[model samples]
Target chain A: MSTGDFIFTGLGHAYLKDNWIFRNYRGEAVRGQVLALLGPNGSGKTTLLKILLGALTPSEGSVNIQGQVAFVPQLFQVAFDYTALDMVLMGRAKKVGLFSQPTPADEEAAINALERMGIGHMAYRPFHEMSGGQRQLVIFARALVAEADILILDEPTSALDLKNQNGILEWIDRLARRENLTVIFSTHHPHHAYAVADQALLMLGENDFESGPVGDVLTEKNLLQLYGLPLKRLTFDYEDLNVETLVPVFRNCKRRKAN
Target chain B: MTEKTVKQEKFSACSSGRFRRWLPKTPLARPWILGLILLIAIIGSLFMGAYPIPWHRILEILLNSVWPFSGSESAYLDLREITVVTLIRPPRILVAVLAGIALGMSGTALQGMMRNPLVGPDLVGVTSGAAFGAVLAMWLGFLYTPVILVLSTIGGIAAMLGTMALARVVGGRNDSLPLILAGFFIGAFFLAGVGLLIYLENPFYPKGQRTGNIIYWLLGTFRGAGPVKAWTIAVPTIVGGTVLMGLRWRLNLLSLGDLDASSLGINLNRLRWILITVVSLMVAGQVAVSGVVGWVGLIIPHAARMLVGPDHRRLIPASAMLGGLFVLGLDNFTRTVIWSEVPVGVLSAIFGTPLICFLFWKTKTKGWNE
Candidate 1:
C-alpha cells in the first residue's frame, strides 16, 4: 500500500455552461501527501476539490482519484434544525447499511469524533446557531467521521479565532502523524500550510501551476509572482499569527478597499 | 502503529459521542405509539360513516369474512352487511390509508432528499401532473372504472417525468430551490391547461356533465372509490415508497448537499434521478386515485419528523403510517362531522395549513435550518 501511487495526469476541469465560475484548469493531487491548493479568490480551488470528489466531472482530461474520498464543503448549511451530533453522524453514511438506520454504535462513533475536537458539549446545540469557529470544528469532525483515507476540504479555516486556528492545526498535525490519512485541504492561510503540511500546490494559472515542499515552494519570490506583489515577512516577539503577509499587487487598483 | 491508530481511534470515539447526542432516545418509543394511533384511526375510520352499522356486526363481519363459519345460519349476515364491509368500507379505508402513506412517504423522501423543509409531492409537480393526466383522460370520455384508474396512473407518471425534466433543465442538479421554482411554474401551466380543458368540455359535452366531473376530480375525493382502484394505486405506491425507504440513510446524506453526499460514495447523479422518478411515480399513483390532496404531501412528513426526529430510517415509515392515519381521520371527519360529503382535498389543505403554521410558530426560536 505504501508503494501504491495515486496520481492525476493531464487533468483539466472546468465549470458548467454560462457560469464563469471556473475555466479550463489542469491540476494534480497525490495520495498519502498534502497538496495545498492556493490561489486568489475564484481561482477554482474549491472547483478542483469538487471535481476530485466526483461531485462534478472534469470537462477535459482524466482523473485517477483512487479509493473513497471524504469532502468537507466550505459552506455547511443543514436543511433541518439538527444537533451537532446529527451533523457528524452523517459521515458514516457509506459504512452503515443502506437501509439500516444509524444504530447505537454509529451514534457512539459520531459522539467520539465530536469529543476529540473538544466540542462535545456543543453536540446537542442547533448547528445553525453556533459561532463560526464552532461550526468549523463540527464540520471538521464530520469529515473525520468518514474515516476516508483521502480527505478533501474546501477552505478548512476561513472563519475561526486565533485559538481555534491553532487548536485545529495542532489536531490536524496529530491526525496526519498518527492516522496516515491522506489529507487534501484548501486554505487562504499559508501559515497553516507551513505549520502542518509538507507539500503545496500553488495555482499559478488556468493550466500552469507549481508543486513542491512547502518551504521551498512558498518562497518570497514565489509569493510575489503568484500574487503579483512584493510581500513583507513580519516577525513579532512571537510568530505571526496569520500566514506571512502577501500585499495585493494591484493595491491601488481599488478592489481591496471595496472588499 | 499504536500512535496513528489511537489518533484515528480518538476521533472515532468523538463521532460515537455525536451519534449519542443526535439520535434521541425517544425515537424508539415513536413507532409503537404511531402504530397504536394508526390502529385506532383505522378502527375509527371503519366504524364512523354516513350509514351506521353496529360495531359488533362490523367486527363480526370482518371476522367471518376472514375466519369463515365463526357463526353459521342465524349469524344472519345479509348482503347490506357484506356490501358495507367489503365494497364500501374496505376500499375507502384502503384508499385513505394507501393515499395517506404514499403522500407521507413521498413528502418525507422529497423533503429529506431535496434538503428543503417546504418541499413535498405537490411542490415537485407530481400531483398537478397526475391531476392533468386524469383530467385529460376523463375529457376523452374514459370515465369507466378500470379505464379511469389506468388512465389516471399513466397521467400521474407522465406529469412526474415532465416536471422532473423541467426542474433538471433549470436547476442543473437536484437542488431544492430551483426544483421548487420549476414546480411552481409547471403547476401553474398545468392548472391553466386544466381550466381551459374544462371550458372546452363544457360546450362540447352536456352543460352540467363536464362541470361536476372536473370539479370532483380536482377536489380529490375518496368517495365511491373501490377495492380494484385501491389495488391499482397500492401496488406502485407501496413499491416505490419501499424503495425510497430502503435508501433512507442515503437520502439523509443527500440532504447535506450533493458534493458532501457524493464524497461518501453515494453516486449522487444516479440516486438523484432514481429518487426523483420513483417518488414522482409514487405520488402520481396516489394522485391518480385521490386527485390532488395538498398538505398530506407537505405536512405529514414534517409532523412525522417532529415526532420521530429527522432520521429518515424511522421518519419514512412513521410518515407513511401517520400520513395514512391523518388522511383517514380527516376524511372520516369530513364524512361524519357534516351531513354531506366534503372534498377531502379541500379539507386536507384547510386542516394542514394551520397545524404546520402552528408547529413553525412554536419553533420560531430556531431558524428554518438547524
Candidate 2:
C-alpha cells in the first residue's frame, strides 16, 4: 500500500486559552516520498508532528491518513533496563494479541530489522547502556519492525555526531526508496533535507507556512525568511562530483555587551 | 574500514547469545518450578504448628482429601490431627498464598504502569489507606469482616484515585515524579489518620487492646485466616490476577511511557484505568484480610525480574508464584522458628530489607538492563 498519502486542511492548534501556536495550516504528503519539516525552535514543528501522529487533536480542520503510521520519537528514557531486542520487539505490540506474547516469528522480524540497520549484534545489549546514536538506530529499527508504510520521525538527527547523522539520513533515504515507504522527519539542518527529502514544509510563524517540492520550497529566499538570517547557497563541481552547501553569512549579529 | 572492523568485533562480542543458552526455552518452566516449591512449602508448613502433626500423617491426610474415593483412610490417624492438618492449616496457608499472589501481581502491574521499580502498594498509599479504613472500622466497633473489607476497599481505591488526580493536576498526565510525591503525601496523610484513630481509641479500650490492634494493622498477620476470610481474599485475587495476567503483554508496552504506548495502538486511558481498578481491588482484598503487608509486593517482583528478564508474560506469573513461595516460607519460619508468633509483615521487612539491599547491589554491579 502507498501509505504516505496524507492531507491536512486548515489544521490548527491553540494552547493556554486563546494563544495560538499554529492556525489554518494546510499540507499534503504523497506516497513513497520523504517530507522534511524545517523550522527553528518554538515554530510548532513538534506540535504539527504530534497532530499528524494523532497524539494531539487539531483544534480545527481534519487530517486524512491512508494507512498506518509508525512514530520514531527523538529519544526514549527508560526507568528500567530493556534489551535492544526487547525494545525492538515492542513494535510488534499492534500485531500481537493483548494477552499473547511475541512469537518466535516476531522475534525473527525484530532481529531482522536490527540486522538491516547493521546493529544485530547489539540486540541483547541493554538499551540504556548504548550510546545515543546506537539507541537512535534501535528506535529506527523499532519503527521499521512495526510494518507501517508511513514513518514519522521527530528530529531523528538532532543530537548526533557528523558520521551518525549522515548514517541515519542515508538509511532513511535508502529505506524510503527500497520499500516505497513514506517518511516525514523534522530537522534543524537544511542541508540534510536537501540531500534526502523529496518535499519540504517550512514553518515561518504561527500562521504562515510553506510546503511543496523540495526544489521549490527550500530556496535561499524561503530559508532566509524562515530563520530571519542571511544565508548563501554555494555549489561546486569537480571530477564528476557535485557539492551543494547552504552557509550562513554570520555578519548581522552584534557582539554581546559585558554585563 | 573502521565501521566494518567494529561490526566484526561487535558480532563476536554479542553476549546475549551466551545468556540465552542459560535461560529456559519456554516461559512456563520457571513458574512451574516455583509452583512445585510452593506446594512443598505448603505441605511442610502444615506440619509446623504447636500441635505437631507427623509428615506421614500430613501426606496421608492430603492424599485422602484429594482422592476420597480411594479406600485409604488410615485407622491410626487421630481426629484432632486430621482437623488441624486438613481443616485448620489449609485456610491459613491458602490465605497467605492468595495474599502473596495479590501483592506480587499488583506490584508488577503498578511498577510497570508507573515505570518505577521502587513503587509498591505502600509507596502509592494503597496499603496505608486500607490500614486507615480497617483501623477506623475497628475504632468504630464494626469488627465485622465484611464491613472492614468494604471500607478498606473503598479507602484503597480512594487513595489511589486521589494520588492519580493529584499527579494529573500538579504535573500533566502520569508524570512519575509528581505521582510518587502525591503517593508519599497521601500515604503519610492516611498513616497519620490511622495514628490519630489509635490515639482516640486508647481511652475507651485498655492500652494493650489498642496497641495490639494498631500493631496488627501495621504489621500484617494471617492468624485470622479461616474459610470465609480465605475466600474473601481468594476470589478477588484470582479474578484480578487473571485479568492482569491477560494484559501482561500490554503492560510491557505501558512501561514505554504513554505516548509510545498510544502510538502502538494501545488505548492509554482505557488501559490505565483498568490497571488502576484491578490493582486497587487486589491490594484492598489482601489488606482487608492480612493488614498492610509491606515489601512482599516490592521485593518479589524484583526477584522474579532477576530470574525472568522484564517481559511481563514470564515476569507476572513468575512474580506471583515466587511471591507465594516467599510469603509461605516466611510464615513457616514465623510459626515454627519463633516461640512467639511474629506477624508476617514484620518478618517480611526483617528478611526483605537485607535481600532487597543485596538485590540492589547485584543489579548495580551487573547493570539492571543486562
* Winning model by TM-score: 2
Over B1-370, each residue of candidate 2 has an lDDT whose tens digit, in order, gives: 5644554554333233323412433443467777787888877777778677777778887777888755366776799988988888889999998889999999999999888787888888888888888788778777666677778878888888888788888996446688889989999999999888876774666667866766775689988588988988988899899999899988888988877777877788888888988888888889888887899888988998887777777789999998888888887788778998899999999998999899888788866433
Give the top-scoring candidate (lDDT).
2
Residue B325, model 1: Cα distance from true site in angstroms: 1.5
Scoring model 2 with DockQ, what do you get? 0.45
What are the TM-scores, per candidate, against the unseen true structure?
0.85, 0.89
Local distance difference test, each candidate: 0.74, 0.83
Q: State the DockQ of every prediction.
A: 0.44, 0.45
Q: Provide the DockQ value for model 1.
A: 0.44
How would the docking of model 1 be graded? acceptable
For each candidate, C-alpha RMSD in Å?
6.1, 4.6
lDDT of 1 at B95: 86
Give fnat, all candidates. Answer: 0.77, 0.52
Worst 10 residues of 2 chain A by lDDT: A249-258
| Interface RMSD after interface superposition, model 1 | 5.0
Worst 10 residues of 1 chain B by lDDT: B12-21
